[model samples]
Target: MKRFIAVLVFAVVAFSCSKEKGNMVVKGQIKGLKKGTLYLQKMNDTLLVSVDSVKLFGDDKFLLSDNVESPVMYYLTFDGNTQEKKIMFFGEPGEITINDNVEEFGWKPGISGSKNQEVMDKFNEINQQFKLKRLDFIAKDMEARAKKDTAAMDSLEKEYKKMVRRRFLFTTNFAVANPDTEAAPYIALSELFDANLYLLDTINNSLTSRVKSSDYGMRLQKFIDDVKAQEKK
Candidate 1:
């Protein structure tokens, strides 16, 4: 009985130690991004499981580690935006690296979003729909411009503006509903800016402007500032 008890104790300790060894290290680089936020999420049907979040370094380097099981679909996001480009991984318990261009991935300043698997699918659909419509109008307008058909160009411009307003409304609602989603805030804020631009263009278009020049601008700038600060640690 004594020997059996000792064996059981040893087995328990070994199990715990083995579990520790499974700590996964998720590391990556974001090019063209000075400072930004990132999140690691577990995919779910109704909502995403927020496993971890990190701010990227000045050089856009980041690292996250946790004891996750094998064959997990882990997602990486920037600035909590569900629409931000993401890095996907399928590793057991080790180091993984992603080197991506943030700008090319659609990570623009003042927008919030992610690029996770499910989120990406939805994003692509929304964007494709928007793109097709916009492109059709743009092509028509370009042809009109070449022929100096000011009337057609003017009509197309009005159509484009109307489409923008509709798209903004759709985006705002989607972002509001998915507030917890990283992409939600970005889309919502972007729509807000577009809506406000007609009145705020002069002040907003200034090149050397500080972020605190406006409400949404300040909030987003602060968010970026906070994330970058964390990366230093």
Candidate 2:
């Protein structure tokens, strides 16, 4: 009787642990997607690998669940009859809900339940401002070229370089200010890779120990090492 009781207690504990392992759940709803497919993908080295997928037929709602070892970026790929759309978000271990229209899928959807994704959205808002400024500069440059105005073209070229420099500085500052988050190292590597090596090194050094040990952080460190090796040649 005593042995049976001990074995039963151990089984209960094991079941609880297994349940906790698959704690991340993602539910998505697309208003106009009657028949399509949704894929939940994550980066594996240089490839986007599907971790979960669901087929939709006469319904717009689908569910995906997985065990996330750490907070990382995930992609929701929607395959419709005419076109495909991909939306990215930072995924953590919890329930995340995404709701949007299939017609305007990439235009931004209602994403909630992940704090890291909130931070990413905030960063994207600022990044969009820089993108608009670049577009304006290009328009002005085109006008100068059409007029054959050499002096104006030179001036606009200088201004365009300055704008590019400002964007790099903004990325550097964002990484430095958000050193505790995984996004910091990610932005440092992805956005500021072409910046000065010293600047990149500074951002890497400023990262918190937790961020430095993250998946993106390790990638950033490897990028810097590769840059150093190329400089030696």
Best by lDDT: 2
Q: Which digits, one per residue and each the tens of the lDDT, describe model 2 over residues 62-87? A: 88877787678998887642335677
Tens digits of lDDT, candidate 1, 1-233: 99999999999999856633336676666777777777777665457676766666677777666675433456667774555466554333556555667766533221111232234346546867987999899889889999999999888999899998877666555544443333433333444454543223322232123233433344444554455577589
Query: TM-score of every model?
Result: 0.39, 0.85
Compute the lDDT for candidate 2.
Answer: 0.85
lDDT of 1: 0.56
Off by over 4 Å in 2: 1-21, 81-84
How much is 198 displaced in model 2, in angstroms? Answer: 2.1
With a 3 Å backbone cut-off (N, CA, C), the pairs that clash in candidate 2 are: none
